[model samples]
Target: MMLAELVTTADRVGATSSRLDKTDALAELLARADPSELPALMGLLLASPRQGRLGVGWRGLTALDITHADDPLLSVGDVDAVLDVLAATSGSGSAAARTGILVDLAARATASEWDFLVRAMLGELRTGALSGVLLDAIARASDRPAAVVRRAAMLSGDLGETARIALTGTAEDLESVGLQVGRPVLPMLAATAATTTAALEITGEASVEYKLDGARIQVHRQGDDVGVYTRSLADITHRVPELVEVVRALPVNDVILDGETLSLDEDGGPRPFQETMSRFGAEVSRDLVLRPWFFDVLHVDGRDLLDEPLSVRLAELERVAGDWRMPGLVTADPEAAERLSRDALAAGHEGVVVKAIDAPYAAGRRGKSWVKVKPVLTFDLVVLGAEWGSGRRRGWLSNLHLGARDPEGEFGDPGGFVMVGKTFKGLTDELLKWQTEHFPEHESHRTASTVFLRPEIVVEIAIDGVQRSPRYPGGLALRFARVKGYRDDKSPGEADTIQALRALLRG
Candidate 1:
């Protein structure tokens, strides 16, 4: 297929607010794609290339002085080939090679195609075709069940692979995709509630488990071999040898355990989140030992428990994890739930997650099955822009300008975000350095004092509450906002909504 064709379809997908229309446009595109092209095609449509980060940033693209072609000619395969070269090019003199390659590619693509290509490379594609929507498109194009496509994608942890399989293979082939002891699956996510009582109202007779402020990990063990993965399913087994050893010590011969790991202080209390994350991020650091707190068991001894109810899974988890199981109690009483929440908070943990005892694990889906309750007011907001620091913090992006999601276009563009607040508080020197090094990669534009970024980085912010304000588009502003941490696991689409933030006024 022509890259122009994909660009045109993406334009169509972005032009409408109707999800049905978006799905239809994407399905039409998918129907015309060759089986071998689905992976690269899906990756482009999702603005996440199959080759991963191509080392091409917006600054590199803007630095090109080549003129785009007038005629449409670049094929999807051509773009994929270029990206392959770009992904492979690195080390000394790689910048010049990448720039030379970009110049040739840019000169080959038409103006519109070049625009789409730039957006795709910069991770700024604004089409409403999210993973879920594209899964529907794949189902429609392949004449398969949406549930089957979704399940396959979740289990395989690759949308492009899932699309290829669904588009080319039979129902039996798709169904054959099941939990593997070595491969990582998507972790189940949680919705949020104001209180444990409210969370219990969502999940009756719930397992009120402590919500640890730590890095999420999925450990898969077979015999003595174990692999550890982050929340995004990136393999980190070599980096987390202590965790691998812990999983290897489990009595079961084969298991897939989902849990959080954090470094504990001398008193056995959880360390600060950043300290835990710093330890987690290090390639080799044995000074800080991270302990696993298993919360859910997905597979054990050749048996898959993803289809089983939470109560059954928890029983299996307790049997396998013993003292390592996350602390919680099964209860229907609101008071008991509140007590657990208080105890969790008292232990320096985040709060509590109330999960329905009978709900089956729905990987990669955030539904009402599990609800997290935090007494502190915290919301995930996108980093719209960051200002350079002053005084002791000079030369770092310190003051964060936060934006809340405007999903319905009530306050701004649909699926865009509205600026709600700014903060320089709670930023450590390490975080400041990170902002300085990485913020430029996401930069949309810049001024003397601030560098505006594409709405892609999600950061968790704690606020006292919201107050009415005439300074912002949303007519509400965050009060006393401070950084909790960057949520590398989440996307801009998953950021908290403006409506949800404004709801604080009522409280």
Candidate 2:
């Protein structure tokens, strides 16, 4: 299929706000894609080539500028040539050369051209669609059930595998499917509750571990080699070399451990989350010291412990990890656990994750199975209309408007929907500039600089406290509430329901 056709469909999807329209367009586009092309297609759809965590990227800028310049320095052919050069040079030359080519491309292109290219490169054609939507499209195009495609994709972590299976015209159920290495698995997450008392009750256990504030990690080791992956399954072995050594030093040869990676102060206490993140780039060698705290073991000597109970896994972890085990495993009574949780909070940690001793390793599942209890933090919300961001944040008009979800769903419906907060925090400066520019495009109404966006973005905010309010929607207001990035990739529809807010307030 010509790239233009895909581009046109993406354009249509972006212009239309309806989910059905977006899905239909994406499906049509997926229909024309070759099975082998799925990754490249995903890359295009996600605009992976151009997305930067910080802002509108140089390649995206180049693509936009070159496409519509009055006296263009580079032609479409030249742009393609540059991409070819980039692809070829990506792994070769110094990082400098790679950056130079992209910079040159952007310098030669126009701002409008850069904008289009940016969207294309980020594959963020926000037409209210998601990976699930794309899976449905692939299924329809191949004349297969969406479930089959989804299962294949989930099991293989590769859409190409699903497409290939679909092309074979074979009907297969995923439950019977086996695991394939390199396939992506969704990360398991914990649900949040307003209080430790409530969270403990939900789990039917008086005992729970305070969820530690650190980066979640999954460690896979074979013999002397170790690989560390984030909750997102991105291989970050290079970033956390200390973890590699820690895992290598383990008594067991072949093992897979799941845990958190934390930065430690000279005194052995946990450092800030930012300090842990700083360990990712080259600066890590100079700045931060990292440590791995094992929580569970998944594979031991080629045996998969996923089916085993957490009690068994924890035992295996303790036996094999020995000295490398995470600290503070002493059994605590309910009251003690609460005190420990409070201590964690007082020490500036996020909160505590409480776990049941007998729970199985439910890979990629989230529920009260593991509950996180944190102090309630509120924010005065401002309703900002949402616009698309890059990669996984492409569609669904994300980044959020921060009005407190009304408990009563009445009052200014302040209980209903009153806008009182807005922020571009927790984002890099690049993201800030992008949001500032794009915020206007989606504006429903405007005050001088702050656009009164359609109430779409529902940010999951974390704050220090809530207080009485007179100017906001709810009679209550948030104190020092700020964006905690976007919630574990939830849709607006799946946001914390009004009922949840009511329960929280009542508690």
Against the reference, the lDDT scores of all candidates come to 0.89, 0.58
Q: In model 2, state the lDDT of residue 171.
A: 68
* TM-scores of all candidate predictions against the true structure: 0.90, 0.68
Clashing pairs in 1: none
Candidate 1 TM-score to native: 0.90
Per-model clash counts, in order, read 0, 33
Stretches of candidate 2 off by over 4 Å are 15-24, 49-117, 139-184, 326-333, 346-348, 356-362, 376-420, 423-461, 464-507
Write model 1 residue lDDT over 1-507, tens digit each, in one string.
999899999999888887788889999999899888989999899888889879887888977887889999899999999999999999999999999999999999998999899988877788767787899999999899999999999999988889888889988998899899888998998987889998888898999999999889999999998999988787888878889888878789999999999999999899977777776567786689889999999999989999999999999998999988999999999999889888998999999999999999999888899998888888999999999999999888999999998866675456778898889999989899999999998888999999999999999998888899998888888989999898876778779989888767964
Candidate 1 stretches greater than 4 Å from native:
387-399, 408-414, 424-441, 446-451, 467-471, 502-507
RMSD of each: 2.8, 8.5
- Clashes (candidate 1): 0
